[model samples]
Structures are given as structure tokens and as C-alpha cells.
Target: MNIPSLPPPVTRDKNALVLFSGGQDSTTCLAWALTHYNHVETVGFSYGQRHAVELEGRPRILEKLRQFSEKWNRRLGADHIVDLSLISHLSETAMTTEMEIRVMENGLPNTFVPGRNLMFLTAAAMLAYRRDLNTLVGGMCETDFSGYPDCRDDAVKALQVALNIGMDTRLALLTPLMWKNKKETWQMAFDLGGQKLIELIVSETHTCYIGEHNRLHEWGYGCGKCPACLLRKRGFMEYQSEKKPI
Candidate 1:
């Protein structure tokens, strides 16, 4: 299948504003940016997550950013972590706090953060306008995400269009992992920086919405039953076994 093309690049600097979430996908994108783009700056949100445990690891994520930054030096600019908790005020979703993310009996997982991608992208757009960045590297995906509606390709395209009009300037949104499952995503991490990134991510990156920090259940912080954990296990198995789908 032909992957959808991003809008043509506009800014001369070719600087990127990444919607980083301190997860496997975003970290890989951050690494990908270092090898691909002329410049890349990241932006993360703290919008009252159901599990604030990851919030505590934001500094570590930034340090990961610095590890890459020291290599690129002046080419890599500042990595910004925005505190956009006001966004949760717009919606009362379970991702906003400890609302006991419920399973809908026979439907998608309850950890879905509605409008999360929309809000994140919009915030990136606003930041990009200030930086005059032409490209936005967003890691949101339907491939192996939290099953949020806004993570769909259609939603991304719509946001691209709306953001262009809203900013009165063209912005090309690049999704490096939109077509890859978790294993492929993890492999991309390995490819970009070898096994080190994967080990660091598995050890540091937090994906649990239920707020499990201690006890070291299985792979990382999350319980093994949740979708995120199941996907993590599957991906880690595929990575270790060399049976990656992609």
C-alpha cells in the first residue's frame, strides 16, 4: 500500500517540532530526527494523565534528548516539555486522572484519550508558529496505539489541513511509525541506535495508564493484561525472536 504523502516542506531551516510523549514511538522518532532532519526539537505534554508515574520520568526523557543533543551540538536545538494540563479541563476522559480506566465489556480499551492527538498537534502547531518550523513530527498512530479515535490517519490529515489554515502557513506533519506495529516501532529504535535504545525504553519508558510503578511486572511498569502491556510483550517477543512482522 502506498503510504500517504506529507505536505511539501515549507520552512528553509527544515526544523521539526515533535509531539513527544516519552514513549517507545516518540523516542524513536526523536532518534530518527537526529539521523534524518536538519534540526528537530521535541515537545511533550503533562495533561493530567491517569498515571502520573511517567510524568516523574520526564526528566529522564529529556536527558535522553540531551544524549542525542550532545552529538548533534548546535544542529539540535532545545527540547521543550510543555505543561499543558489546562487541556484536560476541556474533557473529563479517564486519561485525565485516576478514573479507573474501564473496559467497555466488548469494545476497545478504556485508556483511550479522546482528542489527545488533536490537542497535541494543535499545541505543536502553536509552538511551530513561534519557531517557524515547517515540519511537525507526530508519533500518534492507529497501528498500536491506545485506540483513540484521533490517532487515525484521517484525523491526522484533517488536523494537518486545519492547522495550516489556523496558522496561515503550510505545515507538513510527518509520522515515521504510523504504518508500523509495536515490534516494528521497537526495531526502528534498534535500527536507529542499536539495542541500546530498546533496552533503555523497556527500562525507562512508561506506558501504563493504571499507574503501576513498582513490583516490576513482566516487562515494565504496566500490568500484563492491558492492551499496552500485551502489545509490549508481543513486540518484545518478536524483537527477541527475530519474527518481526515488518
Candidate 2:
């Protein structure tokens, strides 16, 4: 089905609180925020995981994100980075444990941390409410990856309704890549001109929840056997093929 494009700039205020994980989708969402909002700030959660190495890559990702932020900050925005790491102990899932990550066999994958997006978005809305910003951008997608229930559109809309009623604020949960697959997501990031988008995504973000943070190569660190590594490898290859000369 074709969804007609809404009016130009369906947003009310340019201020937004982005749920950044320093990954491809979130990073791409950050780039999208630069083009849409007047003020955008990012919040990254350092959830305890076997692959704590991804957290180590945050500073580098922030440097790049900050650069992107500067361009739009001068025009319609500014950006900031915030840390929220206290909830790692409260969650129970394969992502925060030493247990091996299982493939998606029973609908959702094991790496789907329970209530992650809901909790994150709710937290972000609090910050958004404080700033009186009605726009909130998250990096959750239901395409070609973990089928976490929280990443679905219904969940997002439900949460949005709850958020507004709870705080009496109308916050729009904008997901530019929700309907897109990983292949299209890569291309969007490329067109956004992240300079090293392919490289940045392939080498920077930590998808492997395992403790193998030391592994590095043409496609960053991963166990190479997990669901995430496999999906990423497939996407990277597709992205490369898409860019190659015919």
C-alpha cells in the first residue's frame, strides 16, 4: 500500500530527544534530525552487555555526530549527549547477559531486551517534556533484524498516546527508517553524507552483545556467528554492491 506523503514538516517544534545507540539506524536518524529539527539532543544507554566494547566506541561516534550537529546547530539547532546506564541491572534478556545470543526462531530474537524501547522512549519524553519539545525521534525498526515487539509501529503509537496523556504533551515519535529495510537504511545514511557512513556503520557500532569487543576488521567487531553479525555482513555486502559501478 502507498502512504501519501504528509504535509511538508509535520513537526511542531524542531527540538527533539533522539535515542542514539551509535549504530547505523540511530546514526541515520541523527542525520535525519539534523535536516528536520531546530534543536536535537541524543541519549545513549550503556546497558550492561557482554560486548561492552560498543560503549567504548561512543566517543568516536559522538565526534562524528557532533560534527553533523554543528552544521544544523548553526542554522536550526544544537545537540548534546547524555548517558543513562542505571537500568542495566533491572532488565533481563540475552543482550545484557553472558548467555549466547540465539537466532530468531520463535518470533523475536533473544537479544531483544524486554521493554527497552518503551523505557527509553518514556525517559526521552520526560526530557522532551522538560524542554517543551513535542518531537521525539527513535531508532527502532521492524525490518530485517530482531523482531522486538517494542520496535513495532503499534507499540510506538501506543506509547505516544500514553506519553501525551501522562504528561499532557503531544510528542510525535518520528521514525524515518521504521518502514525501510536495512539495505534502504544504509543508502539513506549514505545520501545524508556522513563522510564515512558505510565505514562508520560497518566499523563503529557494536551489534554483537557478546564480550568479543576486540575483534576488528573490514566490518567492525562481532562474534561473526551471532544473528547481528550475520545480518550486518549481509547488509554491508548489499550496500557495497549497491554502490559498485555497473
Please report the candidate that would top TM-score against the real structure: 1
Q: Over the stretch 29-104, how does candidate 1's per-residue lDDT look in tens digits?
A: 8778877777778788888776677767756865765675466445466767777788678767666755666766
lDDT for residue 122 in candidate 2, whole number 0-100:
85
Report the Cα lDDT for residue 78, model 2.
Answer: 33
Report the lDDT of model 1 for residue 132.
74
Give TM per candidate.
Answer: 0.87, 0.83
Error of 1 at 156 (Å): 0.2
Instruction: Evaluate all candidate structures by whole-model CA lDDT and list the values in order.
Output: 0.74, 0.70
Model 2 earns a TM-score of: 0.83
> Worst 10-residue stretch by lDDT in candidate 1?
1-10
Where does model 2 exceed 4 Å of error?
1-13, 68-70, 73-87, 103-107, 244-246
